[model samples]
Target: MIKSEIKKLPGSQIEISVSVSWDEWEKYIELAAKDYSKEIKIQGFRAGKAPRDMVEKKVGTGALMDAAAQRVVQGTYPKVVTEQKIDAIGKPQAEIVKLAEGNDLEYKVVTSVIPEAKLKPWKKEIAKVNKEYEKKTAEVTKEEVEKEIEEIAKSRVQHVDVEREAQDGDNVILDFEVKKDGVPIENGTSKNHPMILGRGVFIPGFEEQVVGMKAGEIKDFELTFPKDYHAKNLAGIACLFTVTLNKVQERKTPDVSDEFARSLGKFKDLEDMRKNVTEGMEEEKKHELKEKRRGALIDALVENLEVEIPHVLVHEELHKMIGEFEMQLQGMNITFEQYLIQIKKTVDEIEKEWEPQAIKRVKAALALEELAKEQEIEIPAEEVEAEMNKALAQYKQIKDIEKNIDLARLYNYVKGMMQNEKVLEMMENVK
Candidate 1:
């Protein structure tokens, strides 16, 4: 028979004491000895073929009981938790209280429990933020719209052959070589390279000297690299560049008229294009404003939460955020280890730096979940299915993920997302 005693501790913690009868302990000891026999050697006997009495004599009853007690704890913990109905959060910490040949095997487990979340009047705070946002205006200026139009026109420009001398804003094709102290530098020679003057595509003063040079003209110039140039050897050093201007091409831009707008497709005229651009800009501004409002609401919600968040929850969130950061680094063709070296920090230091933010994020999540529960917010089955399908479609590009999808876990994730969205919508409507 097994027995347990449960006690509630301060700060949403619980202590459970579990005791196993002597008969039960003896049974586990025999089982553990049998398991240990498989790896023990005895003279004149094959492995695992030693007599039980000889095996006990070889490994000692104390060592055998110790291993048996470990197994007993592992096997009995779940039954105690389910019988006692303890909502444990993270892993349970165990300490042996009594383990001997004849005494009942006893151990104590200390664990964190999920605390009941208490939230303040977050809706009122959200309303205050929303009212402030309503009074502020986001507008797109006329110059901004005109700049977009100009960029579109510039993108459509064509390079044409010209007989005049090279000028600023003209595309020049040239062959060039750079030398330092009359020694040819590595990776400093190119043939028929196309450069646009006044674009600063070359080193400062390099392209400026090319201006006014006609076709088939060769010119030589010297310029000093910046003190903070990326290559340490060339920093602040003067280098000579020999250039040959093969040809000059002038940019021919299309007229900003109805014909040009029609060529862009879907626009009837310049006015129509301008109208659509203005509308698009307005929509973008609205999205920015919405994001700002959402941020404000989350901040307010985090401030209103009054609960003791589990340390394990915050630690898990920190690790998750770090994983996300690593993924972003990978996307940029960089490794997390490389990033750590470049930033001159250890992983522990990075985790310490992110601790406060992780705590805030965990608190915000708990508060949202509590608020949703209090408000009786529920997601429909059809909506969850649709969201799961949409997510599956997005990830269908991965070769094997679609075939091995975890439908239950995906549905739960989608349901959680839908509930969060509904909660945010409620906060947005608080007036």
Candidate 2:
């Protein structure tokens, strides 16, 4: 006979225990050996043809036993959850609780799950938000556009001139090589490389060393690398750079005029440019105001609705954010594991740090979701259809996603979310 139990743990975690007799463990060993047999490469035997006893002797009872425990726990976990009516969301962390040769195999699985929190109603507050928004202006004026046009024209023309010494914020052209303990790091020399002064794009103190150096001058600076520097070989070590300043130039802005305005390509005149600028600025301001107000509304609703978040959802969001950050690192040619190493942080440590922010995000999402429910607020079917058609029309030329997606559901979800956000914004403005 086998006994299984789940223990509720602190921090919204649970521990599941499964204890089975030695005979049952042996049965699992036989089952698992078959599944993993083909992949085992054994000398003097064709793969998958080795007898279970022979395999056990070759890989040892420990290997087979471990595999058996894995199979037993994984196979039983879902059943336990179903039987208990437990709604688990993420992967459980499994550990061996009891194990001995010729005895029962026992293991425990621990994991974070969701919390049960209720949401509250926010409609009465929504009206005050809307009234405040209605009182405020969402406008685009001609004067604002004219000022933008003038600024754009003025910025279009830049004055460049040779300078004797590289000043702060001046653009520097140089050939630089950085080394720590006499070892080269990343492209030792670059010829006429465009370097922005004071950007800290180079090793710490590199730009400061270049400061006041004239064209055709050489300088060397020593600095300590950041304690947690990304380069493994350079972290917390002193480094030096041999830099040869090739040239220096100062940047200057120009005055706005009709010719500067026409540089923007086919602007009939300053007046026409100014008018277009004003209209665009007004539209942008309105969009920003709409978003700002919407955020306020959601915060109010979350507090008003009194949301209780699921722990599983918070971890899921944290994982998602971590994934996004890792993707950005990927584009720069480094994996998240590599980044973690650079920061000197273990994955668990970083995850723990992210939990608080993740919880907040989860709470906010649930609160808005609940408000949507309490109000019976929804995007009309017609609105969903229109949004879908609009999206497809906008991305008609894109392949794969645009062609294969279920436009209706995606549009409805997006529309529902947008409506909820707007409603929150309206609430904020009212009071």
Candidate 3:
């Protein structure tokens, strides 16, 4: 049997002082002795074969009793939480107060609970926002559709060799070498490199100097690197480039017509292509509008509500955001440390910077959750099961995820996401 004294503290914290019965402590002590016996050899006995008395004597009874107390605390904490309804937000801080062999083991656990939500009239605010937001009807104009068709035609453009002088928008093949202080700079020479004039691929003044140069024409000019250039060695320095325009190429765009549309694929004619593009554009506009309104609705809802968000929740959100940022960095093949260096911030500094945003996110989430509860929004079990199964199925493809993931927690997360979406939809439809 276990007994506990629970004390409420400021900031939704609770302190639970628990005492375990002698019999229970003894059981864990015996188990601890068995574990200790596995580690060391005793005279006239193989490893782990030592008698309980011998093991207790070998490893001090105090150490064994302390281990037993920890075991009891670990095993009994859930029962305490269930009986007391802790609604704990994070891990508890546990300290053993008494661990003597014959006396009942006692420990105290301090932990934070989920804070209660105190909010304003969210429904009225949402309704007002919904009414104020006027949905714009998106219409695709003929000129816009024709512009899209012209873009498609440009994609199919062909380049043809031309004997004329190089001009802006003309593709030029050239040989060039850059020199600083009359010495050829390494990695500054190329032959037959193709570049479009005025594209700004080369140093400033290099391509403009190529303009009006015919095939086999060569010229020399000086160009200054940008003051804020990425390379410190060349930044704010002047260099000379010897250039030659080997050839000039002219671009020829395909004609926009029914034949061209059919050639692109799957389109019966030009009208069919235009109709498809219009439909796509309309759908894109509608999705953009919906997203805009959704953001506005959430902003309005958050503005109307007020709550004292707990630090634990904010910390959790901050960590989650950091994890997402880390994933993005990983996708870019950059290490988190490298990103920190680029951003010129320490991990602690980054967290401090994100604290305000984290607090806002937590408050908004709690407000939405409270609104959901007040509106009695419930997610169907079948829908939750379906989402869970779908998520688990995705996990099945990734090796070792099954071992790491907790299905119960994932189910709750999916259910919560569904509930939030449902509530948002309800708010969106408000008149």
Candidate 4:
């Protein structure tokens, strides 16, 4: 049997003073002796075959007691936390206060836990937000549908080789190099780079200079970068560019017609295409508005919430945010280290900058969790299992999926998500 005294500490931490009875301590000591005996060799016996008493004599009572204390603490700390209903976050810091040969084992464990949250009248706030947004409607105009069609038509455009001088809206391929004060600028040299004239992709006057240039023609010109250019070093600086025009192609965009609509799979005619595009736009707008309203509701709730967020939770959140940021950088074909170098900031600096947002996220999550409890919202085990099975089926092509994924942790995460969705839906229906 074990005895423990729990004391609440500052910063959402709990300190537990644990004492294990001598009888239990003795059992652990014997088990520890047996484990140590596995490595101890006796003169007349095979390796790890020595008796516990013999092993204790060889390794000494102090080592045996220490090992036993570790075992007892490791075994009891989790049970104490669970039985006490402590919502611990990170690893506990344990310190053995006493580990003697015959007396009881004593230890102290300090762990960070989820903090208590005091939420405002979130339902009333949510209802007000819903009522305000209820007056607005998502609508797609004819011009918006036409714009979508234009983009689709542009995707199907063809570029035909032309021997004439480059003109506005014509695709041009060129080789160019830029120099600042007779010294070449970094990343300013390109070969066979494609650019569409009048796109204003380059510096203001650079495209204009390429406008009248024909294939095989080379020209040298100087242009000044905009004062507000993103690269401060080059901003407002005049640079010389040596350009060689290699090719020009006229862009041919198809007109919006029934034939054009049919060419794009699964459309009966131009009118049908327009109808589908308008519907899609309307649905997208509705989703965007819904998201905006949800965000507003969450923001309102978080603003009124009172909770002392533990540092461990914030640290974990920061780690997650950094991982998400790294994924975003990867999507842009950029590495995290490269991004840091380009931005001239360290990871620590970035985390410090993002700390406020992380805190807001933590508060929002805590508020939602508290609200769920207040509302008595619970997720069914069957629903969680069904969702998990569905998710697993989607990944069936990956062999040994269980080996790669922690199914229990995944189940908890999915359950939490479903509960949050249910709670949010409840709030959304307040009006």
lDDT of 3 by residue, 92-188 (tens): 9999998776788899999888877766766787777777667467777889988988998998888889988888998888999989999998788
Highest lDDT among the candidates is held by which one? 4
What is the C-alpha local distance difference test score of each model? Answer: 0.86, 0.74, 0.84, 0.89
* lDDT for 332 (candidate 1): 97
Best model per TM-score? 4
Q: What is the number of backbone collisions in each predicted candidate, taken in the order shown? A: 0, 18, 0, 0
Error of 4 at 64 (Å): 5.9
Better of 3 and 4 by lDDT: 4
Taking all chains together, each candidate's TM-score versus the true structure is 0.71, 0.65, 0.73, 0.78
For model 2, what is the C-alpha lDDT against the true structure? Answer: 0.74
Better of 1 and 3 by TM-score: 3
Write down the TM-score for model 4. Answer: 0.78
Candidate 3 lowest-lDDT run of ten: 394-403
Candidate 3: segments with Cα more than 4 A from true spot = 139-260, 269-271, 325-350, 390-405
